[model samples]
Target: MKKFIATLLAFGLVATLGACGAKESETTNPPAATGETGATDTTETTELQTIKVAATPVPHAEILNACVDMMAEKGYKLEVTEYSDYIIPNTAVEDGEEDANFFQHTPYLDQFNTDNGTHLVSVAKIHYEPMGIYPGKSASIEEVPDGGTVAVPNDVTNEARALQLLAAQGLIEIDPEAGLNATPKDITSNPKNLEFTELEAAMLPNTVEEFDLNVINSNFAMAAGLNPATDALASEGADSEGAQTYANVLVVKEGNEDNEAVKALIECLTSDETRAFIEETYGGAVVPVF
Candidate 1:
């Protein structure tokens, strides 16, 4: 009977030891239910980098918004801030308040950098808005009376573009030597005796009807509900030098032009998808330069 009792005690001790050993094994190693090489319940997620950019309304912001999903797929969060005035965008980039800007063309950038002493450089040529001659009081260029009032952009380069466009249309003649810098004073002849009244580019659209004719930038025209392709009397051709000279660009502080985020944004803006969006959305108003 003592031997039997010893046997029972021995079995009990063995069973208890087995249970403890099983528990310890479970505590040290866990089964990876996820089925990865090493099973772990702990999960880690990657965060996206944020790229802040400044842009004008119309095509720049519209174009950038379309690329948000593309940027995310490439692991970046694109944030755009809209500005009405041109100065703030470049200054914002120069002051480090923005990663980049997408509004002004390289010519405007060169002028801004020279005037404000800002160090901004273009990373990519995105698109160009052809300057269009939108009729106001005059139903057509031919209907304009002698000394008809014309509204033109006050900015230097744009004013020259306006004059060049008028000259090209045979409304007036300007010195060929003046080139892109032609102004009202550079007119070599005036067939209609048209008088130019200079105003801020953005304001031309608002008071368009008050003048006989208004030379408006494509962006401002579109913002005021005018389609350049259908509404304007005339605009730049796709093969025009304006395509290169006035093409809107992705710009950044000179030193940051080559940064990874800026490069990514450039890639997205110049992508085939972006080109398709521009062609379909703006028609001929905005042309992709890339």
Candidate 2:
């Protein structure tokens, strides 16, 4: 009986050793980490390489925030920094703190580049805020009393645009050649003898009630509940020189024009979804490029 028990025990040990050998052979070529199945771990690590952008509060940042998902598909992240002031965004992009910025027109961007020696360039045209000529106490352009005040933005470039808009309306005539540089002094014909009140752009809406007529920027008009398409007595044509020159642009430092992340952002701005958002949300005050 003892001999038979020893024989069974030895056979059991041999079987156990065979089973362990087979298990080791199966795992000899372990599965490779193709960086695919571990998608969660890959995403958690790659999500850290986000591209930062600076934008204004109105539509720039708002529009960019809507594109986060589209960027993620390309393994990129977008971070938008809202800036209320116009000057800082450009500066931020130039300093490399921001990868790109939105909120200025081609003219403004060109001027900023020229004045500051920053090589910022427009990557895409996003939208344009139409300039509107709103009615004031004078009621009508035909009845403007002599020396009646006409309010315009005081900033250099905008003041010029206001004058051109007035020129387009036949309220005044400017030297056709003066272009965006045309100042109040560039007016060659003013049949109404309308006195011009130059105030900060933001103040134009409030000053309208006090002036004969006010040429308010679309931003301020929207804030004051004035719709360019509905409330303005006159407005710039969609294809006017103003539209081409002052179309709000997405900007990046000169060499970054070819950046893949920036290209994605440009694609986002020019997308159909962004176009619909601009049209539906801003009425005619903001027109989409695409």
| Best-fitting candidate, scored by lDDT | 1
User: How do the residues 1-290 of candidate 1 rate in per-residue lDDT, one tens digit apiece?
Assistant: 99999999999999999999999997888655686776667566779999999988887889999999999988899999998777788889999999999888888889888899999998888889998999899999899899899999998888888988888889999898988888888998998888889999888899988999899888888888999999999887777666558988889888886788878888899899999999999977898877
Cα lDDT tens digits for candidate 2, 1-290 = 99999999999999999999989975784555567864323223544358899987766777788788777876788899987567889999999999999888888788778888998998888889888889999777676787878999887788889999888878889988888988889899988787898887767777778998899878667766778888988888888888777888889998999998888777877888878888788777798876
Give the Cα error of residue 265 in candidate 1, in Å.
0.9
lDDT of candidates 1 onward, in order = 0.88, 0.83
Which TM-score value belongs to model 1? 0.87
Model 1 vs truth, CA RMSD: 4.3
Candidate 1, residue 58: how far the Cα is off, in Å: 0.6
Q: State how far residue 289 of model 2 sits from its true place (Å).
A: 2.1
Candidate 2: the clashing residue pairs are: none
Model 1, residue 111: distance off in Å is 0.9
